[model samples]
Target: MTKPTLPNTTSSSNQKLPSTAHSPVFRLRDMFKPSFDLWVISWILGLVTALSMITLLMVSGWFITGAALAGMIAVGSHSFNYMLPAGIIRMLAMARTAGRYGELMVSHNAVFDLLKTLRLRFFNRLAALPLVQQRNTLHASQYMHRLVSDIDKLDEFILRVISPWLIASVSLLLLAGFIGWALPLSATSKTIIYLLLLSALLLPLMASLKGIQSAKRLSQVSESRRQKLLAPLAIITQLLLWQQWQAQTKSYIAQDDRLQALEWSAQKLRSSYMLLIQWFFYAAVLVVLFSIYQLTDSSTSLTTGVDVPLVLAVTLGLLGIQEIVVPLGQHYLALGNSISAKDRLNALLQPSVSEAQANSTIPTDTETGLALPTGPLHANLTHVSAKIPGALVGAKEVSVRIDSGTPLIIKGPSGCGKSTLLQALAGELPVQSGEVKLNEQDWFAYNWQDQLGYLGQQLDIFDQTLAANLRLGKPQATEAELLSALDKVGLLTWLQAQPQGLQTPLGEYGAAISGGQARRVALARLLLKPRRVLLLDEPFAGLDNETRERVWDSVREHQKQGLLVVVSHHEWDMGQCDVLTLKENVFID
Candidate 1:
């Protein structure tokens, strides 16, 4: 076994500490404030785009009417000019096209920025989780689903909630003011404006509230499908051979069908909202026609030429509101889902009650300070009891002392607490009673995570290059350092046989490599950066005898400087090492 020099194992990727805001909505609000400049650009583009669209429609109407009138004047041998109307029409067309492009680009950019910040916060919480917490997920908790899907839902608040709500409100205000200016003395125009705005408000509100139950169901079923069905892809063949795949697949498909049904129902509600908006739109046009009639009759000062253009522009502007308003009818359910997603993610990301209160002031003698342990690293568990996560009983009354430069091998029968004992030593499982200390102090006193390296029973390999995966242990590790670690694990020859070598991409879950190779690769990652105490669970399970001896020799080199606690079922001659055997009789009935 050979050991090479290693860089410091300091982890600098700790996430930004969470704020003290109580509400998830408020937390999301605080996150969004930093991107205020991007949002402002998006808002301005949205406003400009909506107004240009309204102008486009209104001007088109005016030009068509004016062209007809001019043709009549030409037939009557009277002079008429077409240049001004033609020029305005061309200009409005260009502005409308450009404005639409700018709005899509800027609004999507802001939405992307918001989502990027939010996902970073959420992922940091995942990265900072303790090994014990990661091992406790065999029960039905769809964390990945929430991290990806639920976090993605939050962007709806940007596109569906913020943009539509604010943009439509601004367009309504501007349209009302423009109409009021066109007919300052017309009472009928004021009434039309009031009704148009009322319909805009009511339609969105009703559609939104009506679909809340359906949206909640959608989120719940999607998560269930992810946890119960999609997660079992690894064992799909075993399930098929057992003849249970049909029932399992049918159950998952049932959820898909239910989701589709709810979506169809939501579409019906949106259609209803659209019908209502159209009815109110026609009513507003009728009111404009009536206002023009009153203007011509009461003033006798306004002619057909003046009253006609005013009526067309005001009516078309009201109609153009549907451009900004009708789409919101489809968004209410998504908005509700986004609110729910925000709450779920916030709850998951918050520190535990104990850690949350750790920030409060305490006595000077208190053991909460962050400092490296200077003396020999020793792990002692005194009469400590521990339970398997989500279970009532596990290892009981376990006591042991692990000192630096001494390797401990845990051997046991099938039902023994060997694995749980390793977990307690590594601080992966909570001690139900008594204490587990390092260097005569609580483990928390010694720069908590920096003192322990735990590789649990399972192998975790990401779909990245061999070099990138190795760097998870020490992000600044060099290419030569990675090759050296691989050689120590008996994989250097195998790596050189491949063209890409360290740069080769591993398929998802390391499927492109054999199972033994995956385990060795993970082991190589652990060996790259040694810690004060190492807890490995069955590291030799899949490796051949030769590779096992080589790997054990590699681990022994590090044991000369730190404590080694390994959990394995098969017996081996581990000379000069303290061996502890645990039986299930103590904790089981």
Candidate 2:
């Protein structure tokens, strides 16, 4: 068979995209843009609730003082109508209650809606990342856990920092205006009150700005500590056996202590700032009261100056506003937390250098798209240095060629980069400074997904029925085909023993199946759709010797006309094939 001529595809590496478009400010703004209307409604409702609370307190105080004075005067009490004041108090109370309820409902609904949108965007962006970046840079739970926590912090951001600060500002401004209208006050009193409100608002912001560095450090340290405390069981045991358990334990404890110390410092900082703002508010209240008292002329019988009832009302209203304002000062920590969360999320979401290169370099044949070599497909690597991203060492200056006739077995000690080398061939790790060619063409110039099958060490089983999972390999596959594939992997007996057979549920991560059965099931699925190249990482792990040989024979039979590359610690007793052993950047056969 002659190799088919494929259309030439150009790499996108020369294409330059502007970097400023992805700035943190722009990203945050973009995050909010989708739910802009919801955010607006939330802010408006928050302001309404806060204002209602302040007004309700003010009116109640006025009504109580007026009624008390009227009762004391006897004649005044007989003529004074209590019904209007009582009705007004009831109305204010209702408004306060209703507004608060509405704000809570709308705000929480908005948060969930916004989070839904953000989570979708986050995942979409994650999917768009190059396969190399996904496999190498990110491990099991590290990024996934951080993504959840970071998203949760945004909930706190909207509710605690953004909502409270916005409500406080507008509420304070409106209250100041209302107080000016209700009370006969001098410019000095208005000035002092306004200054106090402004100071109260800015104090939290100042504290947030000052603590940004510390807050970021706290976030980092906390995550590090968490990861340390939850160190993988495999790693912990290895360290224990190495006699380094004491040092590792000390390190974990040290991280815990540092995390606690940072938290304590943050609490102290917030408390100190709150105390300062509270003291200023109290002093301002005294000053306002004194200013109002100076307007009182006792000889004039409460006509020339502010009335006693009015004085009492304004004083109580000032205190009411103070109550609303104090929480703003306490929001500094929340503000810092939100900022830090935003920073960390942005950093994580940003594409790595290799990802950017892959985005720019990977190509597709638009004219004659994805021409899988019909003749023998051969994979060749030339001085290919590749590593798991963020790792200190990996395969370096390595070269190998995988041919179609004989399968390739990669043997190496753990951490010797055998898997990394396999990933390089599978196009899941970008080469540092070499060429990976398939059929004498740059692999990136063609789409290899349709022509390649990879079975990693981890099982890719879902919580689904056996037939449904089998259908994933060949969606239109019939029952007979499913049975044939299972029997090929020596699982037909086991399947027949199950009452439901193909309809049996696999449970989460194939929890219902043994490790060996899961591996065989995965192998059968891969066999259902044969590929030009098959890469299996520890495919026979967890199997007995007899079962392992049977599964190996099935795999070899399936891939006889194709190419096979496997990474395993176990010895294969099969006939002669290519064997490559990796050791410290060198490839030996």
Cα TM-score per model: 0.81, 0.87
CA shift of 54, model 2, Å: 1.2
TM-score, candidate 2, is: 0.87
Q: Could you give the C-alpha RMSD of every candidate to the true structure, in order shown?
A: 5.9, 4.4
* CA lDDT scores, all candidates in order: 0.70, 0.75
Candidate 2 lDDT, 116-174, residue by residue in tens: 87788777766555565465435657778877778777666677777787787787777
Off by over 4 Å in 2: 1-26, 74-78, 228-247, 354-359, 363-370, 389-400, 411-416, 544-550, 568-589
- lDDT value for model 2: 0.75
Candidate 1 achieves a global lDDT of 0.70
What is candidate 1's lDDT per residue for 236-261, written digit by digit as tens?
99888898787768877887787788
Q: List the residue pairs that clash in candidate 1.
A: none
